[model samples]
Target: SAMFRDYLSRFSLNPKQKFKTLSRGMKMKLGLAAALSHDAKLLLLDEPTSGLDPVMRDEILDILRDYITAENKTVFFSTHITTDLERIADYIVYIFKGRIIYSGLKDELLEKYCIIRGGEDDLLKIDRNILIGCRKHYGGFEAMIDIESIGGLPSGVVTEKVTLDDIMIFMNRKGENSCF
Candidate 1:
């Protein structure tokens, strides 16, 4: 009961509120309260912040942060909100279709890959083999390549940091010829 009360207090949730009558954020808070009430050391969450407003979503992230750091617990979180992934996840496992494409520390993955942009001439100058995935638009081309492959690229191209969302998009567009 104390555990339930504690989590509820953190989320500003009232104890007696009917489940269906509550807002989306309230419902998620209630669910979290119930899950953590039994002294749960591991939380397996899928889209935990879905349908909630930005403020509520950030509050949930804060709660999870405190849960992991202060309490030394583990949260196996799943969400489409890439910003949330950047904020809360220390590691990332990327699953495209049924296969695991990338699995390891989040920072390492971000460090390992980057997006390079340039015109068609740029593509001709660099080795296409370096690209994990690439797209050619009307004006130019942008490709996801490992940071290790940077040396093989042309001097005039623009390279930028790749986020988890960007990797996901590139991986989707990679098709059957993926570098995996």
Candidate 2:
């Protein structure tokens, strides 16, 4: 009861408000309060920041950071909002079509994948097995590749750091290698 009250106050939720009257953000806070009241070592949240304003989203992320630090707990958070993960996650699990594409430390995932852009001719020279995804356009092509899988790119190709959003898009797109 006290913990719930504390969380309610911390989130600035009105104690007298009925659940039906609560905003989406307030409902999320209420869920967090309930989960934290237990002795569980792990917390699972699904799109907790969905529909929340940026400020409220930041607040929820801050709360998560504090929870992990104070309790030495693990949070299994699932969301399409990559920005939130970029803000607070130390590890990341990326899934597409019910299959996990990547799961590891956030930094390693960021380092391991890259966006490769080149003319269609140069891109077509790459082995399809090494490509996470690829798209061919009128003038050129861009693909996602594991940095380790790259031997050496053709002269006109360039590689850039991959973001979480890029990973999602590439994984979801139709590609020559559909088995990722």
**Local distance difference test, per candidate?**
0.84, 0.84
For model 1, give the 10-residue run with minimal summed lDDT.
Answer: 171-180
lDDT string, candidate 2, 125-145, tens digits: 777777887877777888899
lDDT of 2: 0.84
lDDT of 1: 0.84
Which digits, one per residue and each the tens of the lDDT, describe model 1 over residues 1-180?
988898888788878877889998888889988987876889999999988999999988888888889878889987888889899899898887989988999999889889999987877887767777787887778888889888867787999999988888887877533322
Clashing pairs in 1: none
Quote the lDDT for 24 in model 1.
Answer: 88
